[model samples]
Target: MIPQSALAIVALFASLVLLVMGNSSLGTIAALRLEIEGYEPGAIGIVLALTSLGFVLGSLFGIRIVQRVGHIRAFAVFAGIAAVAALSHPLHVSIPGWMLFRLVLGFCIAGLMLVTESWINSHATPQSRGSLLATYMVLFFLAASSGQFIVALGDPGMYGLFVIAAIFIILSLVPISLTRSTPPQMKRGKRLAFSVLWARSELGLGGAAVSGVVLGAFGIVGPVYGYEMGLTVEEIAVFMGISILAAMVVQWPMGYLSDYLPRRLVIVCVTGAAVGMALFTAAFGQRSSMHLYGGVALFYALAACIYPLSLALTHDMLAKHQIVPASSLLLLANGLGAVAGPAIGGAAITLLGPSGLFLFLAAALGLLLLLALHSFASERAPLVREQSHCVGIAPVSTAVIIDLDPRQESG
Candidate 1:
């Protein structure tokens, strides 16, 4: 048998590749529709929102695949669907067709991500889970960042990007599919116990939704916004790359701090700071390249911290049995936010110009921060308390704006 450590290394590697590629593809698509294909901004927002809807729908129920078909097989099935959808870019289908395909791709990507996470969770002991989680997070950040950069390499009209996406999907299959390690048989169960998860912990669910909304807005609509403002593809890619890198660099301190502090307090502070930053940019930032760099950096730092803090907050109250459900609920919430984010943010920009993008983001964060305060007020337990558990970094690796759904993984 292959050593479990070696299997972990392989699985993590594959998962990272998929995540980076999967995450990056949305930006490319949005940019292409706006810059290359000359799509209407309103239509693009709806299309992207539709994709988020697909993700939300898939995540809510896709767990059935693991129980019925096994993780490896289910992963392959979704990977194949995503690969096909991604590779079909050459057709440059009509707006309606693109939306339909995006919807399908959304589900496929969600399944791929969920199963990969579950597999990693299965292999890791609590002793090593933190490190494992950290490693996964780092790789996810790198992959997501690198994927955005890939858009800079060629014109969207070329099939190279699609081919690149296909290669990533295939590459993602290598590590886990080839592993000698076999996870424990999945417990056959309902696809998703939505009501159960919601009743258990709404906080984690909300965190996930916020995470989805924040990132989804930036991921799907940021490139499109940049394009409308006269940024070339390369510059647009750089904007995303730099912003994501900022998010990655900030994660260590943010993640570390999350373990010790009340997650709710940290969330309110970071998200509130993000809202302030967005408002500042709307009122004072320049539209020039130099300004874009600074704006993206600021946005990236504050926006990136929200989901992690939310995850930490929700994780605090969860019982052991609740972790998986809670995580799923978080993801689901994020997915819904992701779905709504681009539509609202994109529409804001479409109606009021690019400054509206920041305005939309600022308002959303501000609202969440306020709601968080209300939640704290109603709580029976102290908002800040001694942490009962140590989330020591596992030897591993590894949000949104309104995440109100009581589902999906927060991190």
Candidate 2:
């Protein structure tokens, strides 16, 4: 039987899975709905970009919210706001109004993730935290991927899908809110500069930021891109799910490899593979439909590997207490890149066409590959420390990971 702490972790993740599913489904729905409503591509891009920005602010500020109200209260409040925001889509029809709701949704989702993760972190023994984190990564991808199918259940122009997203959030409130386990004692990290993080692990920081660029564009607008490419509704859904599932398959293996190999070497190989796949996807997209989907799946798989590898690499370098600060710094880098990626992709699509999305991906992956190569050239380590077991996590997680690091383990 699982311990109480382990049980709590399960309850939290179960709730989070639904929450993520609702949000991921909404991303696809929003893109389709905006297009159906006749919004410009640039305005659609701004909405997506604003959502990412809201998430950034929430991740930064969520610690205080948790620390102040405790996890259950925070979770309840955040989930409530998120649900209301989801339902707001049908209540009002203005693009600007929906933009406001998207920002609120992003902020609430970020807060909920931090609250839940902090609870998991506080409960987990270091011996188990690695697997726990990996479980989180797998569940979120699976949940998010499954959510894409919701599109087929109803047209985006209808109110049903929006209400369904709201329903998922409300359902998510059931698990952890009912749990008898204690909430984690949460706190903020000491701020660190980019220079400090780069010195700690150049490839980790750079790769995380680049991963954001690719993932942000893919998550926010990939469905729209697929539709513009003349894919059927069914094809668009499959393409998104296939890309997500492909990423899920490789996350653990890549994380395991990073445990033994030089972390930068793993980053280089993974990013390089993604770069090739992204370029192939762009070119093949014109000539063969089958090849385009295949290339997209593989490209996403390799690109998704970076988030975990980058986190593992960062863990390999930080002192026990410094983990939170490092995670925050790295999260910030990812957020900044995510904020930029969609606008850049939007511009590419505006200037070039739908295929421009793939070009943007390739260019981003190429930049990450270059960063890894530069790190390999520097050979700048002062001393190697004993490595911790690697943990896989999604990009949405915040800085509370310090508690899960084995180095910080205590009786």
Candidate 3:
């Protein structure tokens, strides 16, 4: 039987799953549509990069809207805007118009996540927080992965998929609007400056930024790469979906390993593995779908571990009270990297073709591996007691989600 605490947040979780599914499908569909419309790789990259820019902006400021209007009302407002953004894409097919719409989608999606995560965190007790967070992460990844298959439902060039996406976005407001839970009281927390955070853990900050670059680039360009390589929309859906699912597959083992080993060492190993997979994909991904899919899956499986490992590494060096602010700063770094990723990725694709995507990933992961090795050599390793247990966290999250981490100390 579900605990009362778990049952209490069922409405929020339902809304979260719906929101992610709709937003994820919209992103994949947008990229595929641009490729089909014959947009240049650079142009497509810029358009997609704008979405990340909006996300960064929202992460910085969207919380104020929530604090002002309250959670449920804020959720409804964000959802309404997101639904409009989804429909806007098909209605206005110009690059500028689509860019505007994608930006709005990103901002609103970030806002929605902020409200949902903060609400859930507020209601969580120390006893229930761990299980609730574990459930939340599972649902988040599953919805995102499954949402990719929605692209297979209709032509990317048509209105059907966009309309369906809009419907999903609008429908997400239902549970939240009906929920009886009162809004959580918002509190202002002191933020750790990036310069200070970097001083404490350069490897952590660097790893997070690079992880965002990798994830952001792949999210925007992976579908286009598949489309360019002669994949059917359905095949592209399967390829991307499996790659995302593969990210979740490796998290637990990676997190467990980091708990025992030096996190920098684990990071170096994972980064090294990701680099190898990236090279494999670049070399053979175009020739065989099996190689392409398998290589991409392994690449993400290893690459996605970097953020969580970096977070754990940072936690090792900070006081327990500092965890929340440090996480926000790290996420800010990740957001900045995400803003740059698509442009870098698009430039590579323009020069090297579809396989260039993996090459860029290889280069980024290679840089991160070198940094991890350097940090491992320079810094004294933390004792086991000083280290925090690793938790699998998504880089796209708002800082409020950090409160749900079991590593956080009770007030």
Winner by lDDT:
3
Write model 1 residue lDDT over 1-411, tens digit each, in one string: 877766676765676577556547545644565447766666677787777787776665677776788878888898888888877656765777778878887777767766776666666654655566666666766677778877776777777777776777777887778776675454432234767655544555665677677777877888877787778878878787888778877777776676677666666777778888888777765556767678767886778777656655665666545554555456566667888888887888888887888888888777787777776667643345543332312111111111111222332
- Give one digit per residue, the lDDT tens place, for model 2 in 288-311: 768978898998888888877887
The Cα local distance difference test for each model comes to: 0.67, 0.80, 0.88
* TM-scores for candidates 1 onward, in order: 0.85, 0.92, 0.97
lDDT order, best first, reads 3, 2, 1
Off by over 4 Å in 2: 1-6, 381-389, 405-411
Winner by lDDT between candidate 3 and candidate 2: 3
lDDT of 2: 0.80
Q: Please write out the lDDT profile of model 3 over residues 51-136, one tens digit for every residue.
A: 88888888778989988988888888999998988998978888989889988888998999998898889888888778878888
| TM-score of candidate 3 against the unseen true structure | 0.97
